[model samples]
Target chain A: MALKVIDTIYIEEEIKEHPRTIDISSKFKDARVLTIGKFGELFNKKSQSFRLQKRNPALILAKKAGRCVLPAPKGFGIGGHKNYYFSHMYNCLYDCSYCFLQGLYASADYVVFVNYEDFLEEIIEKSEENPSSVKTFFSGYDCDSLAFDKITGFAQYFLPRLRKIENCEFELRTKSINIEVLKSMEPIKNCIIAFSLSPDEVAKTLDKKAPNIKRRLDAMKNLTDQGWNVGLRFDPLIYSEDWDIMYSKLFDKCFEIIDNNMIHSVSFGPLRFPKAMYKKIKIDSPREKLFIGPFEMNNGTVAYKNDLEKQMSDFCQDQLSRKIGKEKIFHCVSDVV
Target chain B: MEYSYSIRFVVALEAEAEPIIEDYGLKRIHEINLFKVYRNNLANYWLIVSGIGSINAATASIFLYQYSNANKSSFWFNIGIAGYFTGPAGEIFLVDKILDEVTCQTHFPRSALTKKIKRDELLTVSKPREPLSTSHLIDMEGFSFFDVVNRFAVRELITVLKVVSDFPSYGYTKITKNIARNLISNILPDLREFVAEAEEISHKELIRLRNPASYNEVISKTEFTQTQSKILEKLVRDWEEVFPERYLIKEIDGLKKSSEILRKLSSDLNNFRIDWL
Candidate 1:
């Protein structure tokens, strides 16, 4: 089994004398050289025809400033209205079995677009279109916002611009220990640093290269100490044997570093995946026991039986509500907000 | 001298690769990833079952190349289990070439590749988990060796060999993990000689890569935390300034943004309490 790095060709016109792209070459030292084909051809290749292209992942760096189609940030919420989300990078450095990006993309290599100015311009224009005054932009939907904090300076370039906008808010959702990025920058009131958590046992088995829950919590503590807004996300909650204790302890840990008054919002959801996508992932790694179970299919999605899902969600909601008020807790689901 | 080489066996899985080294009395030069390297008296070598994916293979190849760096000439026989396209559960293959099948890039060159091995037109997919396909042979790490050794111009350095354990139809389930574990243990001696012969090379133009001096300047210019600064301090000390200064700087910038984004998102949500009905 080789490093299986396909190939990456340089595109000079995209970014001018960018230093970050040069750094990517060194991280993958001695990686083989492959053709640099067009963007649509390389990233969107799922069929067998383009297999010969040797699609080595590339890191693109550009400036993104503003845009159109800015989701109404205040009136609508994430399962409720237009929430504008953007991915500066596609694919992650870590390989997790349940990740959707694996089935969604053709190549395993990561392609980072080095354009930050362009993204900013679009966000600025969209935010101005609505007079609601409060616009929220979501990062980490396609990729973990902080996982590669060492590779791309996303938060650094985007945060200053967001702070200048009167009714704009930004979310940095991640499972990374690299919070030092925040400590060095100017503290803006409109930003919320969200941490994704699971039980230690579950993370050890599934999170792959992600920093353990403890490390992430510690990072959150450091950020909160510096007067930053923090939130907890227990997403895609994988069911384990000792359900009650696993979640209770996870909550206890979060409330330790976070001020009860400063906690922004908390959300939880059950483990689920698209049926066809799940099947493809199962074929990619057949030995994974997590996928081979009595999963219930609900609304073209697979999850625990309805009763089990209700039980897990209810238990988490009830117990978590005791520590923090019910008002700060929200369940992120497509069906209801 | 024109050399005639035949690939004797290709055993997949690190567990299987280890016992074979013991059974064949091969010289254990390096233990990288999962595979333990062994060689014969003639200097013929075998890179035994290393591990289960491209990352494992690449790491093992780097270790192997470093171990053999001082030798006169060293060749490798990438012998292990692989998934195949043809029939017969136990058919043997001389995989003259290793392809990334997905990227379709032959990252390595033909001269550096194991010879007399047929270019079976098969693919080696790397998985961090278990092999989900019903292909020919499924081992953890192989293509990485094909990739690294070639770029290093050490291709004149090896051979590729594989043995089919389960046909494509069996769904890779029939071969129990235990049965598949012992495949390499059964074929150690033959693989060692094939590698020993390929290690021969005459020294003429040994290409050495050049270093850029700008790295040191970046390190000195950027501001880093005590912990961040400490990491940079150690890295610079160990490798005489080829360390990635720019990567460290960008990391510093990223950490700054992450904290800023979180702070902004949180404060915006504060004081907004909507009771669920």
Candidate 2:
């Protein structure tokens, strides 16, 4: 899906004159520009409904003050020993029904941290601190890495700088088909363009305002065909009556065009959320039918029943084992679980 | 059970409220002396004429909310006149940013209606001021009206609309009660259109809050704890969403205890297979 036109923008007082902010502000000339002391003054305010704000979200441009990079949550990475994630942006352009951002954030406005240099500086420092091991730096945990690239210029600014970090591997996870910036640049060996995918039926029903599975698959093929290593993420495997057939067809379609050798890693996991977050999401989208599935609370986490989860996981694992090696496949469990 | 959609308009003057009350055919309720309240019982439209200042607007809004029995889904609108730095006088604007001159705090009201109406920034001062050279639209109650109503409802459900009554060129002295009435009267069609769009949005929320027909049937037949009642309400809602063609009451007719009814409903929903196609 293409990015929609933004109608409003809130700029932080400190970053009002920042070059990146000015560059972004230039793109949306017709949008109403409002100044504020901090992004949180509006973004974190109470009584702001994420559901309502999602309809017409504003963009907040601010500066990331400190700790631009942090360690990734447990059970959240591919295979790197040291996995860290950085968020230069908060909130995604797409509004998937199962997205945790709806619950994690009070408002649905997009917050772009214009301080790209601070994040790069911290990433380089962390990578240098762990020179002996391959530290995987994951982007798009809190937001899509490339979905808002045209507005934020995140990939254009960060990719070349990250390419120089030899000891670190950077993963840009996204469901977006916006890859023109990546296509223009020379392929970096350490950068893996990971595309999150689900069955066509599941995605059509649950992934609102996102690119369809076909478009994502085509983007993946286009990227990998250009010698860029790609990662396949079937995480949050949705469960339905025909889930087996649906996922099998999805896997077959993915492997048909792209060779298994071009894949850097493949990860899949059951749909799950922390108990508190699950409740929040349920409250946020009370009429959503997806929450009516066979889920149970275990160890303070809400997910498919243990037996059902095991059955689905094993079936996918067995299916994936036929195409990819076991070493390259990872099972992502919820950190709370 | 049926859920009615509601919208409350908080105008600062009786003259400002006159056109809206007449347009919606609202009758004045005699009980409330704190503020002048008017309502259309059949349409669920309400209006309160708050006197003047920031405190009066906030207090009158709360009073109307309680007196009218407004719910979380109800839309609250602070609509009235304001003075803009440069205005031809009948131009109306939906407020996007509200700056309180006393506290210097800013508030942003979230509304999809901005796309339908022209928007501007509003400065809520402690008292009326001479038109400044700045671009802010001046008002006396916008900030407090927004701050207080926001606590009771989501930002999207709360809005502040201002019509230019006076400007630097046409000062405040020329504006009389008749002019105020005429300004609002001339813009009644646009105001009605805005309220209609707001009501359309509020109707969707009301549907979300509406209970299934079987909910009242089941609750009337059995006694349940407050916690169990909430659970049953959710189950009933899920049942209606998933199996709208089927009657939940028919499935739980013989169940006496709330626990039994809850278990039965859960088991049926869990066992039901959903076809994505």
For model 1 chain A, give the 10-residue run with minimal summed lDDT: A47-56
TM-score of 2: 0.97
What TM-score would each prediction reach against the true structure? 0.53, 0.97
Give per-residue CA lDDT, model 2, range A131-188, as digits (tens): 8998999998999999999988999999998899988999999999998999999999
lDDT of 1 by residue, A38-74 (tens): 4443344433111111123344333333442244323
True contacts kept of each: 0.00, 0.72
Candidate 1 whole-model C-alpha lDDT, 0 to 1: 0.56
TM-score (chain B only), all candidates: 0.52, 0.96
Q: Which prediction has the highest DockQ against the true structure?
A: 2
For model 2, residues B83-141, the per-residue Cα lDDT tens digits are: 99987888889899999999998898887564466788999999777777788889999
Cα displacement (Å) at residue B139, model 2 = 1.3
lDDT of 2 at A263: 97
Model 1 C-alpha lDDT per residue in residues B248-276, reported as the tens digit of each score? 34433443443342332233222222111
